[model samples]
Target chain A: MNALLTSAVAGLTAAGAYALLGVCAVFTFRLVAVVNFTGAAIGTAGTFSMIGFISLGVPLWPAVVLGILVGTLAGALIGLVMTQWFSEATATTKAAVTAALLVGIVALGLRLTGGQSPKEFPTLFPGSAFRLAGVEVTVASVLTVVLALVFTLLADAFLNRTRTGLHLRALSERPMAAELLGVRVRILALLVWAVTGAFTTFALMIIAPQRSPDFMSLSLLVVPALAAALVGAFRSFPLALAGGLTIGIVEGMSSAIDGISQYRGILPFFVILAVLLWSQRGARWDEAR
Target chain B: MTRTLDVSGLVINRAGLPVVRGVSLSAQKGQISVLLGANGAGKTTLLEGLSGIIPTSGGDIALNGRSVIAARAGERARAGLSHVEQGRTVFRQLSTEENLLVGMAPGADLADAYDLFPELLNRRGVRAGLLSGGEQQMLVIARSLLTRPEVILIDEMSAGLAPVVVQRLMAAVRRLADAGLAILLVEQFAALALRIADHAYVMRRGELVYDGLPQPLLADPDRLHHLYLGDVQAA
Candidate 1:
């Protein structure tokens, strides 16, 4: 019973990180009508940033802040390119930009460590555990879940309660009308990028320390996060959160199923693809907006 | 009543093809100027050019003595030129109130839009996509009013609307003009255009073929039939 509870709690923590990443993906997808495949690359970039700062003898506090700051800057730069250079750019062009960014960032990661094996990441939270209902839950896991909830709530509030958020939604839904209404369409697009970038960076800084911060390992988070976003049909915050948690739990549960762990990598793809195909029977990207 | 818009030798090209050729027109304060044309007559294109949404290949658009052809859409709007484009281009997903709010700048009085079309205020929280055609037109026109533009360019204000709705829209146009807003109305309906226009210009194949006062143009049935209406016998 203790083992089962601990597994579930750990699964819940992983879900929180997935939710954070998923929300950012949804934000970008809704605003620009493009799925960001390179989102994980941005996370990897943040991890490198954190480690780079730490290597320079900077304290952990400043290093973390510096990492998040770099992430924010990355988001702003990506947003600028998408909005200004690609205002009238085609769908294919936007996708190309994200793909290029991902490749460039990953290449930068290999170059930064000079082919040395990637090291264990520094922790943001104390690696301590507490027992709840006979379940041992780590401090990092609790913090991840709490932070994810906080960010998602704040984002939801920002979208539903603020005038600027309304304008941004208008810009996303019908760009031409928003423009006529004097809403700055280009700026809104850039803003979406900035917000997504910041979130991706923060999420990476929080999670990268638990695993290898190599390009492939970090980039794989895109699949689950994207699955979370997809399951939400690109809307509904609660659903996205639930979806993220579900993926994380499923990922955890699969580990206990005898030889199923060997095929764990293949399960998410089949499950997500099937679920998406079933749910999105007649949905089109343009019609949603 | 003190607004004026003057377009001189306005040349517009789309994809290297000339759409409006050296077309010069004007709308004086408290006056309604109508541009009458057949399908693809470059009527909408000219309005877009004046509003700064479309790039003009040549010529000048001056709103109250300030050149606006090269200005950005928002800048031109700030300079007191508003456009109600051919399509009732309201933000469809936004609630009626939200759509109106978007057009109402931070500094402007939103109540004026509601004053012009009180029905929009009634359906304030409703999504704009669900509004009736006439209601959508009213909302769009009312929203554009937020800019308090000296010149209001309306394209096909009557298209796809019921006759009574068209009458209401035309009446609204008249009221705006009476309040000193220079209005450039582009329409396909000759009778409707002539009803409120102080002056009218006829376009055929992207060139201005006739420019004159409304009464004389309306009275000459034979000339009108040959130039605009398909046939007198058919009418």
Candidate 2:
């Protein structure tokens, strides 16, 4: 139906945001061995802080920059803890630490923002760019798609072509070996976290206005992002981008059906579950990478 | 002889248990000092401690007559101590050429690494993980060489390889020593290692059970077997 097409087109913005988050997840996990469960929560905190800055009558653009810096700082702090204490820890241990941090940040985020209350989430880009299938296409939607593609292209090039990228790839695959080879593991890890932090927050900020934005709701964007990451096996950036867009389109199509609209949030969880089971179909429970 | 790398009373602990128990050894410039031991004799631990990959509980590590005890793993590497760790820890996703470039010195040439392991040059675009075991070992050794270290610590270079590949790698190690770099080699093959070694050491239960010239030990198999009694399979 025409309604389904409109909804699918509308989902493009969320798809772009999901792609960005997925790319970030891939980047961090590849370079630093961190399965960051706090990706969305960190962005939520930063976006709320930007809203706080705007409420104080400060200009919107400066507040956005300051908020992104906060997110970067949050990521840097997490990186510091992991690098200092869990530098040699197994991947599971690192993931557990981030999961604990996510829970803590969620508690803090909810307490600060107040529960279930929707605030005015201002849009950086407003107004529709064009029309398609009797539906208006927003400039923000087009911008987000472009941003996702640009990030994917840039990340692929950096990981393959640059000296730091080679060092990062080396560090990710073999941490102890990288250190013995004279790569500054701690510094590079912090840089990866900071960059991803800035990206995730910006991704969420653009899409906030179109959604029913609450702290908990915003923090749970991690589900789809996680699904997107799973699609790439936390290794390939282009695969992650494609996965993100697909999940967003599916969610949009699901929203077109009244019965599934309320349960749309759980759609990503199912996707994540399906991906996990499918990827490990023939592999045994004891199989390890 | 000028010692390029020196460790005295080195102690490394894992899970609060001392793995390298107050071990002392030295590697002189332009010479190969072979350290032979059983699987659990802590040869790898000692090398890791010496290279600063793991913290030494108590010890003094001096490189080029200067104490490097305060340095971290990366600092030790930059200070000319290269560790080609066991398990052939090449970055799995990176290409063969990228592996060499990752830890190379500022002015180090990729061509030199390629020349050392000519087998790797043909597989420049291949991911390290996809390389055969022999080629991976070659890549790791070549990578360490690209760091331009004064002293290199190579642990178990022949872990899992064909005997011919092992022979080729041992020859490469000898060539590296001949090129004026101090080499501390921990190996499984006693006879092959001893053939190219100037000095020899045998560790048992975290202690140096034998320390002297390689000629005497190479001439006596019974004594070498006795030193490696715990792990009878080591040759």
Candidate 3:
């Protein structure tokens, strides 16, 4: 049906954003051992900064570059604080710091924007739609899907083929052993944080135009993203992407149904709970801790 | 004799309680210095302090005649110190080849590691976690060997290994020492370690109580037993 095809395209667009965010979240968690609750806020800040620069008459490309740079620096600052300033802090304390950072960055973004009102986010992609198999498909939607695939492939290659990527994987597996083997834990941690920060921003740039580019909504997008990461057990990139797409499709399909559509937002919670329960069923006490 | 590693007046405190106190020793090139002690005697703690895994409260560590007391664990490793920690601590998720790559110095070939442990060569593509205990030990040792370290601090190398595997590892370690690398070994198997050790020190409750050639201690079981068990009657 045309309705089914339209929803599928819409689902793919949403899936691209969710998959990017999920990959970033999972990568950061594996490398730094922190959940990085501030990821969405950092992306939201970058998106707003790009829009502000565009309004100030800066060229779109340069403004976009500056926004990404700002996001990267912000991520590095957070990493420095966590790895250097609070290196000896417990895992619980470090996680609490990330939560606090989420609040702080969101507040800072609100102050910078002067209000929580929605701003028109710009898109670099051309505004065009084409009829495909009797359903309308936007160019942005197709571009987003392509970009997601390309980024995933690039990320996968970097992790599997590069030397620094091996070091990252080593650190994720056994940090003490990796350190003893001469992996620079601090520098690598900073790099992971910076990359994820920039990546989250890039993903937001694509997704922001599709939603209201406001502080709360943009920041809360991390909820579904996290659900996707949890679905992958915070390790597998391909699985995380698949999980994101599946969630997006389910959400899109649910909206077409009658009575249950009101509870669409609660979908992530159910997915998170189910996945966690299933995964934890075999986990020993020591491992679960 | 050239001293490769020297730790003098070393003291380490964990949570305000001294774990390694006033321990001093030196390892010479082409010799194996074994630190023998019972559980909780701080042999592992002393090895950790030397490798910069744990901070030393007081004293100095000079590696190749340079003070490395202020250097971190990774820095010390890059400066030619390697620690094979207690237990088989490989990157379980990484392939055996990739695990070796972690210790491969730039421009150095992994051929030496593979040559030293042929089993690793056979299972190069497999994840290290799937390897048996002895194989994992071989992988860990081979990985460290690829670093071409001047001094190696190995802790409990024989732990959880079969007797035959322990003998094989000891032979490999002896070969390494014969090749002019200083080896500081911490072992729970005191008798087995003494067979391969040149110099020996006994630790009790964080302090060294006996320091002598292994031959004298090995000749006098009563003294060695007293040192390990605290009293002759206890022995």
Error of 1 at A73 (Å): 1.9
Q: What's the TM-score of chain A alone for every prediction?
A: 0.89, 0.95, 0.90
How well is each residue in B99-186 modelled by candidate 2, as lDDT tens digits?
A: 8888889889999898888999899999899999999999999999999999999999898899999999999999999999999999
Give the better candidate number (1 or 2) by lDDT. 2
Off by over 4 Å in 2: A283-289, B230-235
The stretch of ten residues in a row with the least summed lDDT in candidate 3 chain A is: A142-151
By summed lDDT, which 10 consecutive residues of candidate 3 chain B come out lowest? B226-235
Worst 10 residues of 1 chain A by lDDT: A1-10
Error of 2 at A179 (Å): 1.7
Give the Cα lDDT of each candidate: 0.77, 0.89, 0.85
Evaluate candidate 3 and give its CAPRI docking class based on DockQ.
medium
Can you write out model 1's per-residue Cα lDDT over B13-113, one digit (the tens) per residue?
Answer: 99999999999888888899888877887888888788877789888888888787777776787678888998888778888888777657657787888
- Whose DockQ is higher: candidate 1's or candidate 2's? 2
Estimated TM-score for each candidate: 0.90, 0.94, 0.93
List DockQ for all candidates. Answer: 0.48, 0.79, 0.72
Interface RMSD of each: 1.8, 0.7, 0.8
- Using lDDT as the measure, which candidate wins? 2
